[model samples]
Target: MPWILVFLFCLFCAPAQAVTIPGVTTGASASQEKAPPPEPDVEQKKAAYRALADVLENDTSRQELIEQLRKVADTPPKEQVPVITPPEVEDQKTVLENITDVGRHYGEALSSRFAQLYRNLIGSPHKAFNPQTFSNAASHFLILAASVFTLYWLLRLCAWPLYLKMGRWGRKKNREKSSWLHLPLMISAAFVIDLLLLALTLFVGQVLIETLHAGSKTIAFQQGLFLNAFALIEFFKALLRLIFCPRVPDLRPFTIQDESAKYWAVRLSILSGLIGYGLMVAVPIISNQVNVQIGALANVLIMICITVWALYLIFHNKRAITESLLHLADRSLTFFSLFIRAFALVWHWLASAYFIVLCFFSLFDPGNSLKFMMGATFRSLAIIGIAAFVSGLLSRWLSKTITLSPHVQRNYPELQKRVNGWISVSLKVARILTVCVAIMLLLNAWGLFDFWNWLHNGAGEKTVDVLIRIALILFFSAIGWTLLASLIENRLVSDVHGRPLPSARARTLLTLCRNALAVIISTITIMILLSEIGVNIAPLLAGAGALGLAISFGSQTLVKDIITGVFIQFENGMNTGDLVTIGPLTGTVERMSIRSVGVRQDTGAYHIIPWSSITTFANFVRGIGSVVANYDVDRHEDAEKAKQALRAAVEELMEMEDIRGLVIGEPSFAGIVGLTNTAFTLRVSFTTQPLKQWTVRFALDSMVKKHFDLADVRAPVQTYQLLPAPASGTPPTPEEPTL
Candidate 1:
């Protein structure tokens, strides 16, 4: 058994020895390279294998190693261990806490910066005021100033003639026949001339700088600072002059006394110069030569002076300015003038607030504040000016009453009035819109909102679309109503050279159509507007339908009234201006609606009677009317005579010019219709045109009385006398009948 094991192990070891290790040379190959080893006999190989097997069988360590190798081969390879990193933990601070922390951080930074500024301010002179440096800077500044002054003198001398000519021209133009364009043109010319002078001065200064080879910082700073200050202040003065024209009274744009104009111009110019020079030139030069802290301190002082000066000016002129604005408002009596008056009332306070805010802003963030304020102010002014101009134009154009052609006016008189009223309303709406847009733009300019971004965004786009749709809807609705009204009015009135007068039925139907059209148009416009404005009109429509159904069920009487009125109108039972008897009330129809009719009675009472309540209706003006007169005569008198009297009265009524046209036919007499105890009754009926019954009846009755008197026909009269019933039981004397 040991030999077999050894043999098997030898076989395995042989293949292993033949397999090449990556970096090792086998002993057989090494020997071949040198001298080949002598071949051993098979018996020697067997002897060597038996010896190795005996060693392996007796060695406990070898057995253990083999067992371990076998176990290693049997086991599967281990997989790599995966690494798991924990997710990053979120910060515990909320938004408000983070903001507070940021604010605190900025506050600490600001305080530190301010402290640094204070230290720099205290030490600035020590670092900045060496004698040599001071002398050098002063010498350079004086040289630059002298050069600039020389240049300015030369430029002014050269331009003096032109400036004088422009001024004279402006004055002469003002004295000429004034037009709306003249003042603006003169002011523009003056502004242009002033600008030309400024440009020439600046050009000369630039030439001087270039000629001097202003390479040194001191020279450059002085030239840049002083020249820019001059330009700014001069430009501002030019603007003031344009407005005030202090030297020329007639050229002044505003209506102010010459003394007042000159006063304001000079003072304002001085103030602007002080503020502009102090901030633009003084502070910058100080900072360039000394330290930024001193410049900042100087800036604050200058701002303080400006604020105080502005406040003084505002308060001093507050009452006068307000009164001027009030006078303007009274004269103009327009919406813009009213706004000016309101602004005038608060202008002083507004001015004070503006300066104070500017001071505070400069104190907080001096670098950007002035730029922001100036830009915002200019933009806001431009916005307001444009809006005001547009509004004024709209008002001027739309304020006039619309005049229609003669034919239209004659046919439809109310159309012109209605159109004019609509125009007035449109003007007001346009003005309001312009004001609103101006406010929005002003807010945008002042950084209150980002209007352009909002306008480009989805919400603003949708809003604009909705507004446009609403406007269109309203416009179309107005047009529809106007057309309907015009058409209906044209139908209602008589045309001498055109169509004849509309019948009562035609007029009634047209009026109803006009009202119905108005209601429908209004309903459709409202519905479309609601839908456009992002309202879910489905629910509204559904609710309206349900409500209408409920109303139809709940108010059947209203439905009945409407239905009855419609039928009555269609059948021409009664119309406006017709004498109508509805139920127990008798009146002339004054107005009619879908559900009710407005009746004005002879007693001056207006009754709104629903059609449903009209059980009996009689229209006296429909076709023809008959007036019946009855006269009773004495029993002894002949009834034929009374009939003859009535006939004679009707004849007389027909003879009258006014009543003759009203009487339609001859009178018919019923002789002796009845006999009473005292007299016999004779009835006669007169036929007349519709609506002429009352007039004809009154005239016929008067004629009847007169004719009866002329014919000596007597009506029966019964008389009673109470004889002294003195005796207790004496029967009363019998009443006697007298003719």
Candidate 2:
């Protein structure tokens, strides 16, 4: 048998090569490049044949060998033809051509796959509805269901006391008055309890399957599927319970009515159970037990039902939900209120889009659709909830007014006001940042962005660095302003002894310095911030310089005003609260700026006089003022007596309580400076404090009149008496009056 196999192998192996026999020659070798040797003649062929015949004659299995030889002779030989090389293309395909080719191939593959699915669907029902298969599947499903139901009930019974406790805690009243942590803690406890029950049920079910049903693959598969479906559906129901908490109105985080909460909880649980079980357990089980096409058809039907149901619920409750959201937004005083209102307006559309997207995902990629949707939904809700909570706390804290201690307020009153304003702006920035971060997290969770990778990338690192620098800049800027303002205020405020109140001129200069410092700090901060944000500030600086040049050239009057005002301020010309006269307007200097001074006139009209417009300026409160009084007496009367009366009046003025301090010097009398036909004039002058000249003059005049009257010093009077009009203007007569 071994010899026969070896002989057959040799005969069949490499048929393209010529077979070699002893002393026999074939011309097959001549085809090679190597030249052939001389060929064997007819005598050599006959000798080789004779020797093979003798070997066969000497064999014990002669007949078998002859038959094998005949068979080998009948077998046809394989012929070898000359090798040929195919031609190569001279030009390569373009990118567009390659893409087109790829698209065509992809389309073809898709069409073929779809065609196969259609054919399978057409024949799947016939194959799937076998009574035996149904009996087996039904038996497995029933056993699995009974086991899961028993396990679930047992777990629930064990956890019933805990559930009751959670319910009571959730229903507790006045929870809002409790710590802010109460709601989160209660919700977490309820979720944990629900999750514990689910885990216990699944764990017990798994142990039972491994112990009793380990030998049966069908039973194990069915039980595992049932447990997975239960866990998934129950997990979703747990989230729903966390949100709605139907039995515990106080624990419902959202401002939803009890009835509405209950309605939504029940309906949502039903929906979740249907989708989760139908997709995760039912479709998989059917696909495994029956046909994939039947399973796909079931998946499509279930998704359609879910989509229609969801749309029905959304549309049915659209108006009520929108109104509820609007009311909530109105009640809410947080930064998210506007977002909530906007969401309310478009919530129905978003819901519709969600369902449509789910349907498409299920239709196209049924295997991972449920997992992707559930994960994305949970992550989105969690991100938004956490963001809202944090942002709310921030806004609440920032909304409060910062009260400084009495010492700080006394020293720096404006600091508290500035701090509050800064906090308000910070709140807005924090809210915006929170929203942006939430969006990024959601996108990352949904596979729309690779946030982790981006965070580690160069651009993201630089961005974070820039933000940090900007925040530091802003913080230091605020601190610098506060310290500077506090210092300025400390200098301006009077001490306990009231000895060092800043003069008006000093106050004005300090105010201008403060303003200039603020401008410089602001400009420098902005420039640095712009640079940090990757903006080229050189161009901005150049632009600013050009703008300044243009302003200087175009507004010569403004330039003149500023220059003149600067000189005036440096020269201590005037200050705020100084009684000054400029041009035609004279009043108290109410306010002063770099280019203009606001003065209120005695008549109650305010004038803003630019420094360039001020041609003449007078300051009444600069130095000492003088009061001069003139008194007249009859020339016939005793001049000595009149002078003595005036001297007595001056003595009386000095003895008065109000006028004594204002008088800077003793009164000086210039006797008989002028003589008139009716009277002679006596002048008395006294120096007083600045701006007290008018008061002193009035008091001195009253004293002089009283003295003149007491001394019988009356001024002469000239009177004219007209005759009777000269009988209708025929002649006019001039008359002199008697004194």
Candidate 3:
């Protein structure tokens, strides 16, 4: 009674203490929240927990609580139990349990039936390995082996002769055409013979197995054997084709030495066949009752092994293969054919690289790796193949459309043989499109198409968008630039007369406009593009402004030149075709840009001079000019007669139409303006058309000399006058000539 009472006391106390515990609130509140809550203290918390522990620690009470707990635990749920588990879980559990029990029963019963049958068949368990059973199996095995061997040899004998004869015929035809036709024929013949032999062997093995009434396991083994045998035979046939070339040297596909081919073929064929046979045999074993992951790994390993072996074979004999590959291309192939041959040469190495990648994926991710690899491989091939095909078609179409057959063959013989005006443009455009498509396709195939979406939303989007904007800007800018250039060229052409000479002012204007436009366009495009690309253009602009200010101060001469050149063009100070003399230099104005001019001298030297350097210049071809000739004559000769003779000489120049047209007036002699002891001077002048002053001067001089002789006009003679007053100091000796 005391124990029961203590147990009740502890339980009641626990609930009461819990309700009144500090730092712990109960579900029901005291009336009117009785008193305001007090601050919690560590000492009070300890006291409360200790008090509860003390009551619970009493052995009698603890034992009673334990008993109660045991009773509660042992008590079953109500007769109509409520579901504690989820409905789906309960159903799954029940179904799994029933299936497990049924499977166990069925398996046990089947095993027992099989064991009983085996015992009955043997008449006793001890007779399972009897001599009679062994003898029966041995007889069946011998029959199967004999039948396969007989069929193989019989087919080989008949097929070998016929295959050899046909190979000879094909080789003869191939040699005449120098083609690969015989090579395929040889491969097919060898393969067919071996294939037929393998089929016959399988047929015989199947018959023997059926006749012997072999069990399922025995039949399975037979089937695996036949399959593996078939694989081995095919492998052998491939190797054999690589070797003998079927008694026809011309039919050999590889460039290997005869002896080497035979030797390696024999050894490699045996090894390849054995490995292939083992892989095929292991396939069935791995598929049944094996962990799928392990099976997948095993299959990958076998495939990798085969790939590695093939690579080794090809690499080891690559020299021979290369020779054979190139030989097949021959000299008869066209440009396109040669391109294909080149592609094939590179394809060997590409294939090796591709296989290595496949192997790497297979190692880390056995599942889905193959699918990814195949997809990637096919995607690459498709992109490259399509791009090449499209590019080729574009080139061909352009060539056909732009043919030079009419123009180049007749008038413009120096022009390109094919139409090429749009060819280059089309090719460039095609290349850009192909690259864009290829990149997109590659991204899609690699499952990275989402990357583009992310880029659009991410910070990278701005960069890409900026780049796109820049591209558009550049494209339009280029069009504008080209149009401006075309306009300048047209202006230049129009300005040029029939003599291929343009006016200096027109040429200067066109050149300066073109150059200035280029600079302005480039600067604007770059600034806008930079701003779009997230560059702080404000600072760039500020810096550029500062730099330009500094440049303006530092290179004042450059600014001066530019200003002067602009004014010069507007003032028509000089023209491109003008025969101008700038300071000391004389040349034709070849071309003029914003700040400078290109002057090509008659000596074949070129000069680039700033406009500032030409502060003063003479443009002889601007308008009419004058030629003056000063002739000295004897004081005794009549000045009037000499002047008349000079005029008469110039009159003779009118006989030539070219000189006559350039002459604005007849040549006339001016009165002597100076007299000296030596002679008096007479000046002759002619007003002629621009650029013809020198020509008239030369002709007039020649005519004057002839007229002077005809008129007997004397030339000027230098004389000395002797002074008598100075003779007293020193008489001039005969050697002291007079002055």
Candidate 4:
């Protein structure tokens, strides 16, 4: 062949390689030579050339690679529909490109679109690398995203402040209409502030974008710089508010003795503020830890907290539990006593069973390496299932065969209603939780873990991450909310053998505790789940600990209350309907509890006392009681006559058919105990039945009064006789006499 022909053939067949992108081609221009490639760059070129030659010889692999890249994002092109702006369609296309998951396409679809627009507005526009159509769409998409996100975030942020403002306005306008949540005022304030923030973020972002587009990069970057600064400021401002928000309502009145509510409010507020601060400062830091470390810390902290909380709860629960246990031990508790004893014994056994759950989920045996996971799984299922089924059956049997109380018969409808409601709720909740847990376990058992692994490791698109978080939040939030609700419900539904709801404060304290436990449990579950999927949950663990410590320090009263409650439970301190006295206050035990003791005075006045303050306890209804009395008689009668008459009356009283049975052992009369100018007093003594002393005394007194009236023996009435102030008007009296 001619040299010129050879040159042409060589140029054409040499297989031009600039990362030979299958069909796409690039010129070997001078600009491409500006920078030499990294090590083995020449080798890579030659290999690509060889591959190209081989593909030209046989095209299957090249075709496969081509197919894979194309299939990476199976996006549909935008179709311009009327009334729908280009920006919206562009947003749809961008979302399709960025988001990878097909399953979650329908999930949070609206939020995903909104987030897309937000990203487009805030994200950089790579005009050089991206195609014109795509770049334009992304930019428009970003603008929309920015506007929407700013609006939504701003509105939510202003909600509380708006509420406060509205509350102020409402209170000022109509003091009678004071409400905890001032809705009207809040709405108005929210509208105004929301508009303001939206306008500001948009205007600022736009101004920067436009400035950059018009001429100066420096000026535009500065504006971006300003926006960043604004974000920083907003963050700090939120922190400041968190730190000082407690003082916003000016809780100054609690210093007075009468304003106990104010005092407790102040304490709770301070505690809340400290907790918020702790979270704000520590959450971000702790969130960075790996799941294993976080898990270890969480395990340690939880164990510590559990141990501590158990100690406290035991104290609080002591009084009631001990009473319950004593009744069981003494065999004095009413109704289904055997059944109750059986259930309680089962409960103790079952409490130990909760830890077996960890074993069920364990992929590897910690205690015994020879233990096969399959065998462990089967064993766990068999044991727990059998135990649970047996427990339910036992409970059911007890419910049917337990002793029937007349008191319960009178309130049968109320009891029935309460029992049915709790049963239904418990069953429903249990079913749902079981279904959900089974689903999760099934997914883990199947091949979905690999998908989860990829998704969690930033392998999925940004949109997917956002969607996952939303789904996660809603999912975990639902779990959290459900667990919390269940806890509260169980507490309410469970039989309350010890105390009544004495006061609103005590109720609130109990509710707060129940809610706190629920939240903690829910959060820990979420963190643990996330950790299992490879999320670094160190920050969450650290934050939880710090939050707990802060709560412990700030809400020491609450902690004390919980602690006291446990002690009460374990010690069998007191229970409702028992008579007790603390300090100067004496009243019937209206409500006995761990957090506080309630005493209702004889006058129907109520006194609430924290259990921590109670170092000793005195329970009535344990033994016999004594009644001593002095009966006064008219001085017009002889003292001996009165004593003889009183003795005769007592003897007659004891012998009477209506009154004799009330006396326990005997009636004793001590004669002529006291003397007065107009009357003499006779002493009487009697032993009476436990808890029936007052009724017996009243009947006996009435009998005595009636007999005395029949006998013409009168009770003394003392009257003061006053002479006129003699000296003040002596001269006037003398003049009158002379006249």
Give the per-residue lDDT digits (tens) of candidate 1, residues 1-739. 9998995665444323322211121234322444644555677566655644543555554565456446545555453212211122344799999999999998998798667656656665533546666567667666766876677667656755665566567666666856446556766776787688778878877776665534676766666777777777777787887788777655566788888888899998988787667766777777766667778788878888888888999998889888988887887747878798889888888889878877766666665666577678768878987997898888787766767898788899789998888888878888898898788899898788887887889888777777788888888889889988998898899776877888878899998998888888889888888888878999999999999999999999999999999999898888888898887889899998899999999999999999998888888987799888777888878766777787888777778898888887777777788787788888878788998778877877788889989989988878564554445678656654443
TM-score per candidate, in order?
A: 0.75, 0.78, 0.55, 0.31
Residue by residue across 618-675, what tens digits does model 4's lDDT show?
A: 6555466667877888878766666666667777777876567767777777877778
What are the clashing pairs of model 2? none
Give the C-alpha miss distance for residue 490 in model 1, angstroms.
2.2
Candidate 1 collision pairs: none
Task: Give candidate 1's error at residue 515 in angstroms.
Answer: 2.8
After superposing candidate 4 on the true structure, give the runs of residues whose Cα lies further than 4 Å from its correct spot: 1-541, 562-573, 581-587, 600-608, 612-622, 655-662, 717-739
Better of 1 and 4 by lDDT: 1
Say what the RMSD of model 3 is: 18.2
lDDT of each: 0.75, 0.79, 0.65, 0.51
Deviation (Å) of 268 in candidate 4: 70
Better of 1 and 2 by lDDT: 2
Instruction: Return the lDDT, model 4, position 286.
Output: 27
